[model samples]
Target: MNQSHTYDDVPYPDLCYAYTHPGRIAAIATLLGMQPTPVENCRVLELGCAGGGNLIPMAYGLPNSTFTGIDNSARQIEMAQQKATALGLDNITLQTMDIMEVAPDFGEFDYIIVHGIYAWVPPAVQDQLLAICQQNLAPQGVAYISYNTLPGWHMVLMVREMMQYHTRKVTDPRQRADLARTLINDLVQMIPESENSAYAAFLHTYADMRFDKLGGHTDWEDSALLHDELSEYNTPLYFHQFIEHAAQHGLQYLAEADFTQVMMHDLPENTQLRLQEMAHDTIELEQYLDFVRHQTFRRTLLCHESVDVDRTLRAERIRHLYISSRAVLLADNDGNEYFRTHDGSTFPAEHPLTTAALRYLSQISPRAVRFEPLLKQACARLNLAQPTPEDAHMLAINLLQAFTYSLQMAEMMTCSPDFTIEISERPLASPLARLQVQIAPLISNLRHEQVELDGLSRAVTPFLDGQHTLPMLVDELADMVAAGQLAPSKEHATPEQIRKQLDHDIRYALRWLSRAALLIG
Candidate 1:
């Protein structure tokens, strides 16, 4: 029943995002007071690195840093290798290997990443995965592992069981997925709404989520359902259970990859105090919080147990890091003073210095600024004389706390990747993004963001060298359109209409690329 081949047949779109990058991972580790190896020259390993989508961008951004990716699927590995070769990226190596077979001789890495793999493998394999992290990770290394958490998985598991049972006789992966999806669709219609049964509520909630993911798209949904829901093994564990497993392998929890989850400050004071009483240690506290938050997924970072972890966050740590934020200032009549993030999370901007700092950070966003200069600039903007030592200290603490609790408000990183938001003359695009355009139109930007390109945009991408002027780039698009290779939005339009649309698209694409930080110049 060649189950593993299903993944190769319908490959996962393994794109990189900001949360998974080693730079972001190491920065979080640094904030927690673990002196991780600098991301610039770090050695990284990713298990189940499907198609190397996530690791490739990191290699491209940090040319000096080396990366190795291991996947069990030969086709996915081959695809990744070909893409790496095309980009002239000498820093990364991709291989076909199973997690159970990873050896100590693979050498140590400053950062190890295992995502979308741990909770889906068999128990023995899960143990081996942790062992590999413990043995192959550098003494001060941080490893990022994401898993299906308990309480949240409790609901998902029930739905998954129903899915598997409904399609038990189906052999074809796609058919099975289609049948399971159909089953869920039918159940949603047939099930009675009961306020008492958690199961009924789960079905309603899950149906909405399924529809949201499908987005009326069948092809992509079938593949996702096939791999994620119908995979042969999908085990989940409580937070404490996972911690215990890592402890057995001499690994300790450092922090979550997403910093906001760890910030207990956001919880109501009564809830916080009650939870504190219920939890005797960090592990217990996190497990209880999962119960409270109904957490279904987690991206946890771990380090070797021998290293001392300082859970207490000090404002002084902010000075050692570079900061970036996507927060924007909003108008308020009451002058309550706050900034709102893309996700609607708000941070109080009542403090004069922090508000000035946030405003400045938002202006240069998608680009990181050093902390001291950011603070200095904010102080200058406030029209204040040089901050007294105590004033500076308070500002640092306030800024750090605000950024930590409100992730959308600001982001701090140990280092920044080399890319710019400014559009350049000649306008060079990211070599990695250009390479990705060959595989799929949805490519990762320099900031580890995904941007989807239309036919015109993709056609213009390959020739986005600094040598090509805007006129030349437009001419290339015009050629592509004329040859029937690139299709505009409106089909059967007159040539004049096509030309007008192409001109608009060319300008929009370049500006989009520049804004996404895909412009290298």
Candidate 2:
């Protein structure tokens, strides 16, 4: 394979941000109710860890854990290493080695993450990846594997096919993207605008989309169209097929990362009812439905151990409240002036009754206040001094925007002194959720290791502060060993030998700490 073709050629930084944020991972872990053992002690390995964009953030976030990132591209590995060194992060190690070369020696890991690798690679490599996960995943380990799915991609594939035919002679990436866009645009213009013409409507909508200013990157279109149109193994498997394949490898589908996308909720009532009646097992039913939907793009999590995933409790009835800053008008009678919400999204100015509520909230804090107190405060600030039944209803609607933005308090009544807001926790039934569960065991085990290693690393840090020589540290360790604080090692150890030992011990300690999330490098 060409060196460039071996890895994702584009600098997909945004994709990295979207796929691997620590907050999302933490949220998923919390929803699963799985205790992370510690950050300083876990062992994490990432396959296709391109340029360390994803792994570096993780390593930095969880300093106590040990991270190992592998890539076949030497240039990417070198970039990852440079970033690690610049950041002074010692917990992560990057190697320019193929998966096949290191699979055996890699040993079992607590967490194995492979993003944007499975579907893009050849069958042999894909099989090798699965085999590695099967062989080296610890008993409680979870593997996060993302791949392109089907059904959703069917239309996208059609677009790709069209683009490929039009751009067959174009070799340059930018030119190919432009040519594809032009072809799509031309197709759109050919549709006639007429009532009761569904094809015409489709063409018009497609044309509008082609010219839409917000319609994302041209390069993205080129890359996706090229891959979808040309790739030999761009086959999409049903959920059942994927599950069966995983079963053969000693792994079980735990859950999805995004709970909302699970087909159970969105399927037609009749279809759902029929599926429930026909399918015998939970896995079977899910797989059957997935086939029905022709799911494209799977963010599946596989685990070595079976976990019961029914911890999510639904919010039966939520009463929301909101508080916002008073609108600042440029003129006394300005009709268009409004205040921005906490999320930087705008909110239009309301009537005097609503304006009064906002003004009182603004006086207290420019940032929006909670709903419960805002009503009473509005009453006091407006000189009504008492909240009416009518006022309460109006306040509820005014608070709708805040509730939608997730800025309201956890409990409906924000008046209580103890009231603290919490992001509504939903069930983890998506690919993201499944990934969290699958990795839960590994995270816990690694966290434990991280804590132990962190203590050791901290103890040694004082020695490396540059006051003492290598011989002095060795003497101190020897004395401590004699005192039963540490284990005895070689007597008459040279400075270089002692330094080597310290470095090795520190690296090992840091590795475990990185796993635990205590330190990120």
Candidate 3:
């Protein structure tokens, strides 16, 4: 059977910022008490992995883990193959295949990821997806599926429906998107400020949300609009509806990708009590909470029904994981009881030991520390006596819970990336990042964070083979500028002037790369 591939036109090749990493997925599964397959040497599969933007980073980071990505778009698969080849990664395979055509003979995988595909595909394909999850998942494997959820999506659906109607006759994705945007903006402009209709309110709210994304830069978001809003199919389900769908295939909800998303205490007291009273099971409780929060999207994890998922929060899990934090200490009248992050999330340090521990973690941020050593150091800093076995256990549990609850303040990981904080002489760049520069300026960092390199930075990254110093880099740039391969900031500049500018530019690019965590050393 032939399937129409829409992604070949407007490729959905964006990186899912970090949470999809097998390391993070396996860690969450471990916390739930399911003995998940180790990420180091696991068999991983990704469905609808357009151009390998998300899965390639995991493949690069975990070189021993074998990866297979299947996308319907041949163009996307070709791009992914080129990137893998350029990086000299032998552990990954990219194939252009439809999800419905996936066979059991393809073999089982430890981690199966289906992001941005569940709700957008046809209903028959959705069933086939779950069947694949049931048939191909290892005994203790995990499946991550992200989808558009309902209630909150009610408004989004209205907008998407309008966009689809407006672009009904347009075949070209880009032109359809442009027409839809113009129509929507025109409708909004026609509405008077004095008009207090629900339609007017919805238009303004949606407009604000769209334009405000990408830091109020609308140029890059048009593709997203084309793909999501004007795509052929988009069907969002209620939380319980999705759970029911999973149960049909012998898969049960393990937990959310982010622990804090499932935390009901974050809601208002009255709302929480009301939701608890109305719900009989965890799934129902989550569904009701989604209604309260108006959740439009969810990244949910699933495991076989036979696997026991421990819903209880266990502190013992923290001891085996590595910890890192970007939270910084703030001065206070009562001796710095608060730790804050760049995103403005604040964690109040109520306990003496917890307070001291976070300060230490903040100082050594982006570098992970084990629980035992971190605890010992924090206790020593506080001039506290050695904790009893019980006390030590309790402290570890509390810290882990706090970190999970406040992820913006701290992070815990099941695996660590091979990266360095020190900028060595003639520093070497991340080999994966250097390869990515050949394909696109947007590259994945060692931390799996997507970073967009500027023109100068992009040009310099390929030459950062740990063999070039500042002078050598300038010489190469001078030649390129003289040959017109590289554009000068000021046209008609002399080679000497260009060399001088290249010196400053190369240094700036290296510093930026270091800050972006793309430098290996």
Best by TM-score: 1
Measured by lDDT, the strongest candidate is 1
Runs in model 2 with CA error above 4 Å?
1-14, 17-41, 191-233, 263-274, 288-294, 305-521
State every prediction's TM-score relative to the real structure: 0.92, 0.54, 0.90
Q: Write the per-residue lDDT of candidate 3 for residues 1-521, one digit (tens) a residue.
A: 12122777777645645777777788788888988887888999999889888888888889999999999899889988988887888999999998989989989999999888899888999999999998999999999998999898999888887877777777766677678778877888787772676788788778777745544334446656766766677899998899899999999999888767888646788888888899998998899889889999999999999998998878888787777778877878867667778866677776677777888876655767778888898889888779677767766776766666666576777787777666667878988888778765367888887787777888888888899878988888888777778898787777788888888888888877876778886
Ranking by lDDT: 1, 3, 2
- Candidate 1 lDDT tens digits, 1-521: 43433567888765785678887888788877789999889999999998888999889988899999999889999999988998899999999988888889989999999988888888898999999999999999999999889988888888888988888877877788778877887776676665565766778788778745735446556766777667788888899999999999999999998988976776899999999999998888988899999999899999999998988888898887888778888868976667888777787777778888888888877788877898799889988779778878877887787777776677777778678777666878888877778776468887776777766677888888888887777778777778878776798887778778877888888877776777887
Q: Rate the local accuracy (lDDT) of all candidates.
A: 0.82, 0.53, 0.81
Error of 1 at 159 (Å): 1.2
Decoy 1 TM-score against native: 0.92
lDDT, residue 290, candidate 2: 61
lDDT comparing candidate 2 with the true structure: 0.53
What stretches of model 1 exceed 4 Å from their correct place? 1-6, 193-201, 211-220, 383-385, 454-459, 478-505
Candidate 3: misplaced stretches above 4 Å?
Answer: 1-5, 194-201, 211-220, 332-336, 379-387, 454-456, 471-512
Displacement of residue 171 (Cα, Å) in model 3 is 1.4
Q: Which ten residues in a row have the lowest lDDT in candidate 1?
A: 211-220
- List of clashing residue pairs for candidate 3: none
> Alpha-carbon error at 374 in model 2, in Å?
20
